[model samples]
Target: MRAAVVTVGDELLSGDTVDTNASWLCNRLDERGVSVERITTVPDRIADIARVINEYRAEYDAVLVTGGVGPTHDDMTMDGVATAFGREVVHSEAAEEWLVEHTDYAAADLTEGTTHLPAGARMLPNPEGVAPGAALDRVYVLPGVPGEMKAMFEEVAEEFEGDHTHVEVVRTAEPESALIDRIETVREEFDVTVGSYPGDDVRLKLTAGDPETAAAAAAWLRERVDPA
Candidate 1:
């Protein structure tokens, strides 16, 4: 399965907050055999959010959206989502009950800001915070907070499973330049994807859909290079 990530926040674009959510979600999706093909960062604007979601949802198997869904004014993700699918924003009774049962907030104090969601969206209960996430039309909206995002994602993690990839890593003392020819040879010879990173020690990573193919490629490269 393929997925796209949309991280919404002005803070991310301003570099005030690192977009750890995108990377974290990508890694988790990778482990679940879901390849994340695109990642986008947009300001907390409903139009921008709606545009990307509309585009990505059409192209990928899933679109994972993070951030800007809280009770704050800048939290416009839910509104953007409703606009994307032409759904009306309505109060989610399940979300309100969750707050009353799981949090200290009383029903009388709860406002539409806290309980409203896109009509027909499935509520993904938050295990760590007040605002619950939502799932609608293959668009999974998650919290911007890392802990809450991670916890909420786990609740629906199984839905993203696909063909798993096996990876093998090899470290070499040789420079990347010295290994270029060998890297090309192995890449051409095996059905594996190779990545070479140059650092104190050159690191070669091989990934393939089959475990034996990945292992064989790694072993073949190991025989030709000096191990670090």
Candidate 2:
């Protein structure tokens, strides 16, 4: 499955916070063989969040949104998602019950805004925090806090099917320039994507539809590129 990530927060855009959620989600998705097509960071604007959700929802199989699920005024991801899908925001009964049972917050203490969600959306349980995550029409709304996000994601991780195939090789003595042409040729030949990075020496990464294809491309590149 192909997925896109949307990280929402003024803090992220302002560089006050690093978007570790995107990288972590991508890695987990990759481990399950899912391909992450793109990741976007946006400020805590409702309209902008809706616009991005509408755009990515059409292009990717799924869109995972992190951030803005808090009780604070800037947290508008749930409402934005509802608006994007032309749905109404309502208190989720299941989510409300879950909160009452699992959290320290009483029903009166939970803000009405906190319980509001897109109509017909399923609540993704959050073990780490009081605010629950939500899923609607292939879009997932998650907490911005790293710990809460990770816990909520684990609850719904099984819902996604990833099909990514990757192979990485470290070439200690290889000159990057020497392997450029051959790498490009192999990429075209296998109809796969290849990436080269200079580290202590050189590292080549090949990604394809399946393990066989990735292994074949890696082998071909290894033969043509002189390993140092």
Candidate 3:
């Protein structure tokens, strides 16, 4: 499946908070065989969030949005999603119940500050935090907290399972520039995506959707590269 990941927060944009959510989600999506088409980090503005979500939901098979659904004033993910879908933000009774049952919140006076979600949105339980995530249409609104986002996503990770990917890696003492031509040649000869990087050791990586293709490409590249 092809997907887009949206991370929402002013902190993320300003570098006050590192966007671990996007990378973490991308890695998890890759492991599940889903190709992430794009990763966006938007300020906590409702307009930006709404715009990105609307665009991505149409272009991708699935959209995973994380961040901004907190108790604070800047948290605007739920509102943005509701605006994108032309839906009204209503108090989520189910969400209140989950929080009241699992958290220290009071049932008699359950406030709907951050608990207000798009009407008819499916509440995905958050065993890690107060506000639960929501699934409106093909978009998922998850929390910004890394631990919480992780917990919420694991609950529905199966939905993203896709084509099995295969990877092969080899390193050499030679620099990346020395291998550029051969890497390009290998890519032209194979169905895999070849990548080269210069580090302590120059690293060559081959990735393909099919295992046999990846293995063959790796073997071909291996024969060309001088051993470290």
Candidate 4:
């Protein structure tokens, strides 16, 4: 399955907050055998959020939107999604119940704006926070906070599951440039992705559908790298 991740926050765009959500979500999605084609960091603007979500949902099997779902004024992820799909943002009973039962907040604390979800969206409970994750068709809306987002995503991980991929990393002391040709050759020969990283030790990553194919590709590239 192919997916796209959209992170929405003015802080992320201003460099005030690090966008660890995209990387974390990407890794988790990969573990479920879902390939992420794009990782977009967008502002909290409703129009932009809706536009990206609309485009990505049309292109990928699933679209994960992180950030902008909180009590703050800029928390507009839910609204953006509702507008994008031309659905009304309605009160989420599941969200309200989860919040009131677990949190110290009272009924008055749970306003429509804070607990609203896209009409007909499947609610994904937030184990760690008040703003629950929601699924509107192929679009998944998650919280901006790292802890809450991770907890919420775990609840819906199965939705994105697919055939697992086999991956291997071949480490060497040789320079990155030295391994590019061999990496490309092995990639073409085995139909796997070969990644070259420059560092104290160059790293080659091989990924394919099965273990045997990935291992064979790793071995092919490893044979050419100089030993540390």
The CA lDDT at 6 in model 3 is 94
The Cα error of candidate 3 at residue 189, in Å, is: 3.3
Give the TM-score of each candidate: 0.96, 0.89, 0.93, 0.93
After superposing candidate 2 on the true structure, give the runs of residues whose Cα lies further than 4 Å from its correct spot.
164-166, 188-192, 209-213, 216-220, 223-228
Per-prediction count of colliding residue pairs? 0, 6, 0, 1
Largest TM-score belongs to which candidate? Answer: 1
Write the residue-wise lDDT of candidate 1 on 1-228 in tens digits. Answer: 999999999999999999999999999999999989999999999999999999999999999999997788899999999999999888899999888999888998875587888999999999988788999989999999999999999999999988899999999999888998999999999999999998899999999989999999999999999999
lDDT of candidates 1 onward, in order: 0.94, 0.86, 0.88, 0.87
Tens-digit per-residue lDDT, 54-153, candidate 4: 9999999999999999667888888899999998888888878777888988879675577788899988788887777799889999998899999888
Q: Could you tell me which 10 consecutive residues in candidate 1 have the lowest summed lDDT?
A: 108-117
Looking at model 3, report the run of 10 residues with the lowest lDDT sum: 107-116
Q: Is candidate 1 or candidate 2 better by lDDT?
A: 1
User: Per-residue CA lDDT of candidate 3, range 43-123, in tens?
Assistant: 999999999999999899999999998667888999899999999888888888888888887866654475778899999
